[model samples]
Target: MSELKIDERCKSTLKKIILFCTVLFLVSVVGAYILARGNWELIEAQIAQMMEGVMDNLNIETNKNFGLSLFINNLRAVSLMILTGFIPFLFIPIFILVLNGIIIGALPMLTGTNFVSTMVFGILPHGIFELSAIILGASFGVMICLTIVRKIIGKNTVEFKILLKYILKKYVFVIIPLLVIAAIVEAYITPIILMNTIF
Candidate 1:
């Protein structure tokens, strides 16, 4: 009976994750398409500007040769897990995930037909695995936070040591593996894809 209850809870959690992913995907597609349709040229211009700022900040000379370098360097900037933890709010990781989903969905639509192939080559290779890991990590973090919130509301109390142990265990078992996957994609797959796609 207890095992059945655990299974049911797992199923429910998975269902929620799927629902959230679907909603994010659909919303991003619509939003990206709308934005691109209204002012794709302007969007590109802004992206170029942002790219310039990033390059300058990083002290990288603006040249096409640094294409893959730029992508790799910029990955950390939009890294959801990295930034989400810094926020003062509890739900920040969830919001970051949703926002990233929107931008990622719209990215291809913003580019030219020729650029789509390039984008795929550059992003898809590592992006698929890398992004999946990021989303999973972020989701895990959000779920853990939600659990804490639930406990707080239910009994209006939680022992600090117990909560701390639970949090640490979740991080050890879940977040660590996700981070390892992310690192693998970033270090090995992303670079090769970027080269093969762009060149």
Candidate 2:
């Protein structure tokens, strides 16, 4: 193909990708709202069950032990799981995304308008960008795994180290900054929003 044609093709591919991502996000959000609105008690029970499963598997002992170290360990574990479960997750990111969206959405729903608005504004400062990074990271991992599996006969030649490095760069570059932004938002902005609402 000509250079101009290639450039046009690239732009078209980019646009399609963006449109797909947007559609995915909207679908997830809508699914979350529907699921959340339907039987909150069941949703709550499912959340508890999931947490219990994690706790059982991880052997989390106490609240004190559930601090920063635990959080980091969990993060590492999840990133590792992404490598293993990458391909499977691509077809079901909506399931995970909706579950999370519902949980986040539920908190505000229960708290009434004042608190909901407060949380909305509080979360927005970082949540949008942070979530995008997370979604993109996951998407990249899923896409890479899918591509490799489709092209290769056996998984023996999967250059896991290189793939892991690529994923980790996204984690370090995108997710880490997102976490920092979220922490600042939660620690500073949330408290201020709450205080202002109260006062």
Candidate 3:
């Protein structure tokens, strides 16, 4: 294949991965929202129960380390998602995305979102980067699946190692940094904004 063809194929693969991420996120969000819409009380109760232990130790004063903690936690999750991308199947990565999507979608429905602009302003600071990293990471995971398809169809000559290297570079240089920024904003800035505006 020529350079031009390779470029086109790469672009096409990126488009497909993005589409997959969007579809999965939307589906999870809609599904979670629908599932919890009429049963918000139960969801709320469950959430409260889950947060009990954390809430007990939750101290705003001790949140000096919260950003770091949050970053590491998110990084761990993203790492898992990216690792799953090494698999030539969509099951695990998609499963992770689906579970996340449901949680993302259900949160607003369970919590009751009013004032769209204010809410967006509060969440957007961190959410934009965080969700993008997640979707992108998940896409990276699905890249192998695409490679498999290409090999079976005789369109791609790239070896699995080369593609894996590219994906790893993306994770280390791109996704990790985005998640770090998101963690900072989420732990520090987002809460302040929410406290002043939406909350």
User: Global CA lDDT of candidate 3, please?
Assistant: 0.71
Where model 2 places Cα greater than 4 Å from the true spot, the runs are 1-22, 41-44, 47-81, 85-94, 112-119, 152-166
Q: Which candidate is the best by lDDT?
A: 3
Q: Which residue pairs in model 2 clash with each other?
A: none
| Candidate 1 ranges beyond 4 A from true positions | 1-11, 41-90, 109-120, 155-199
Over 86-114, each residue of candidate 3 has an lDDT whose tens digit, in order, gives 56645477788787776666667645665
Q: lDDT of each prediction vs. the true structure?
A: 0.53, 0.51, 0.71
Error of 2 at 65 (Å): 12
C-alpha RMSD of each candidate structure in angstroms:
6.1, 6.5, 3.7
Best by TM-score: 3
Candidate 1 colliding pairs, count: 0
- Model 1, 1-199: lDDT tens per residue? 3544544554466458646754664576467656766787767765555445545644234333344453444445434444454343476766666655555545565444343564467556655655555555455445445555666577433343343454455456754554455555555666677666654
CA error at residue 113 for candidate 2, angstroms: 4.5
Q: Pick the winner on lDDT between candidates 1 and 3.
A: 3
